[model samples]
Target: MAPWGSAGKTTPRFLGQFSHYLFRYATWLPVLIAFNSYVAQVTWIRGPSMYPFLNPQYNESLRKDLCLVSKWSPHRNLERGMIVVFRSPENPHVTVVKRIVALEGDVVRTKPPYPYEHAKVDVGHVWVEGDGDKTKDSNYYGPVSTGLITGRITHILTPLDRAGRVRWWEHAEREGVQKAQAS
Candidate 1:
């Protein structure tokens, strides 16, 4: 009877330990997931798409203004003129930032003054161009797969500003409001 009593006591202690660990993991799981899900992740600008705005080679100070790409609102189709971070279609391992020039089915003129051969927009793909023509972007590769887009440019987080400002812009042709004549 005494031996049986000792075994019973040990069983409760083991159960308590297990419960503590379970609770700890349960509480931490959501936070870990949220941290990765929509939070601003750091990335390096590889090329000159952004130019004087975000240059890795010329302005060493830019290394401080790390681009903050958020995955929060990516499921929605990107608006024209929004800078975005996306996986390179030619190279999945690489990511590039460029502006949305045209959406699916939108006519984009590609001629002189423009640096590349003319191409019409394709469905399920959008035209993206580097603000700088010389950089690697849709100009070099043509339209990009919508699926490749990771997220729109939300903000740039740098220690320079205490507030962490985000320098983003919208096009004159605001989203949802189209030119009546064009339609």
Candidate 2:
């Protein structure tokens, strides 16, 4: 015991307890980081690019769609009409969500201003388009590399009335392509 009734003894004990507590939980840090980085994540969608199927209203009072994006889904197996979140090819820092319009080796009809009347998705890439024709997408940037795709959106988690697995039936119908089943 010291003059202050064990004041000298308290500091070491407090530090030891803190070190032990930190050691016990430090092991979970990597797992938590990996889960968020490679497993699944919740994302807030904020734009008119997806429209009717996603954010249908322009009013700020209406909540935006919150979606569950699965990083584990293999981009190579992506089919036409599946919505995916990918890093913009023109600007790697920005992420864009779009529907897979065509897979590798598939022929895609191009819209105005694109040099070719039709374009074939090159190897290791896929053609993506917005649900709305007015949105900027493959029609503007062309086919995007698969490596830029980060995740496949599986479910809408917010706005209870609209919450459910995201389906591409309408988009497929509009594109004249077969709708893909949710994976």
Candidate 3:
């Protein structure tokens, strides 16, 4: 007998058992990938633009905020002050998060670089701005094409106490965002 007595027999038995479970899980891999790609995904918030909301404790810490981004309906209706993640028009290589400040046809009060004092949001376009006002947003760049928005932020999943579903309507009202009328 070996030092562990059943060492030789246990090794082969363990290998056989592990392979069985591995094959069972293998069948579920594609299903998991599909769900992650189409239903929802977890994302990390990395900037100060959405401060005191997302990444609230990120100033000097390594603990960034994690949230759930809903991709269930790629073209779901969006309302003002609702947060979303989209491909950065300036740099397609990066993604950004911002709140919708104005919808199509709504007149927006322009900031410094946008030229005019007020401009109407073009059809299928939206004005997005960062909460912190320190980051580049619609006020810096022109309106974003709605097609670029990838997902709506639906929940915060980190920092323990703040983990829960976000209140989209309340945020919109608090920011004094005018509601989007159905076209």
Best-to-worst lDDT order: 3, 2, 1
The lDDT of each candidate is 0.65, 0.78, 0.80
Q: In the order shown, what is each candidate's alpha-carbon RMSD?
A: 7.1, 6.1, 6.1
Quality of model 2 by C-alpha lDDT: 0.78
Give me the displacement of residue 21 in model 3, in angstroms: 7.4
Q: Please tell me which predicted candidate would have the highest TM-score against the true structure.
A: 2
lDDT of each residue in 1-183, candidate 3, tens digit only:
223333345568777666666776887999888887688989989989988778776678889888999977755688877998899999998999998888898777777777777877888899888777567888788899998988889999987899999887787343333444664
Residues 1-183 of candidate 1: C-alpha lDDT, one tens digit per residue: 233223445568777667666776788988877865576566655666676556634445434346667876674756677888888989999878888777777766653444655566777788777665467766677889888887776666543452254455434342322222332
- Winner on TM-score between 1 and 2 is 2
Error of 2 at 15 (Å): 7.4
Clashing pairs in 3: none
lDDT of 2 by residue, 126-161 (tens): 888877645789888989999999998989998898
TM-score of each: 0.64, 0.78, 0.78
State which candidate, 2 or 3, has the greater TM-score. Answer: 2
- Pitting candidate 1 against candidate 3, the one with the higher TM-score is 3
